[model samples]
Target: MPDTSSRIARPRLIEIIAALATGGLLTLMVLSNSMMAAHTTPLFSSLTAHGVGSVVAGIALWGVWLLRRGQAEPIAKRHIPLWAYLGGISGALTVIITSSTANSALALTGTLALGLAGQVVLALIFDVFGAMGIERRLPRKNDLIALAAIIAGTILIIFARGAS
Candidate 1:
């Protein structure tokens, strides 16, 4: 039988908090970009918002890295790759496309759903291929089932938006 814990450890609690925080931040980012796009060109809004966000996040990370200088170990060479450094480019593309989509017929829910579905599919492929230096973890049957459901839901949301 598996043992059940009465309380969470600090590291586990931190992980939970980080996960929730990421979700909250992403929600806010989508809403913010959409709102901004409503007032200006999607490309301009994406550029401005993503630019500021990148600078702020970079500065914050720099500060943290400075403070942690001897306390934390550096990333191992095996885990680092040129492609891994292209996350900023990916973020830029994501912001541009999301802003444009959010301003189009898809609106918020449809755009987000479709984007998430695409991401889930790509993530599964990446995991299976061990792309970008990640350890390979083959997708299970449940993953494929979940992806199908997500795609179906996205299609429903998009068509429902059109019908309304």
Candidate 2:
């Protein structure tokens, strides 16, 4: 086995914490969206979520701008590719799809498990091909092992849920 001394170094620990926090927040978001979808439609739930997110993001950006108004260095301007703007569309679709699945027999647990599996697969592909300006890197042995474990767990969770 590789040396494990640095496994939880400060930076890595911070990343782990951040990932955990994000996952918790995501679960809450999915639950809220699915509940709304149950009463309203999936499309409506997605639209409402996105609308609120946009307003919140806009306010955050405005606050950041105000805080940095007197900075000496100018903010660098980079041309954002059209594809970069498509994330909102993807987010909307994700909400709609997850909402529908969460309300089905799959429920939140199965839906999250499958979604995580899909995300891992796509992330691996993206990393290999350097999609969306990400650094191109081949999966290491540990990476593959982790991916396998995640996929196996996802399959077990999904099937177990279905069998119940």
Please state the error at residue 8 of candidate 2 in Å: 17
Top candidate by lDDT: 2
Report the poorest 10 consecutive residues by lDDT, candidate 2: 2-11
lDDT of 2 by residue, 1-164 (tens): 54422222223678879987997998899789879978998888888888898899999999999998988886776677999989878876786688779889988777878787789878877767677755566777776886798678768866787678
Give residue 161's lDDT in candidate 2 (0 to 100).
Answer: 73
Candidate 1: segments with Cα more than 4 A from true spot: 1-24, 69-76, 94-121
Which residue pairs does candidate 2 place in steric collision? none
- Compared with the true structure, all predictions reach lDDT values of 0.73, 0.78
What is the clash count of model 2? Answer: 0
Q: Each prediction's TM-score against the native?
A: 0.64, 0.76
Cα lDDT, model 2, residue 26: 84
Q: What is the lDDT, from 0 to 100, of the residue 75 in candidate 2?
A: 70
Q: How many clashes in candidate 1?
A: 0
- lDDT digits (tens) for residues 135-162 of candidate 1: 6666567656866885787678667876
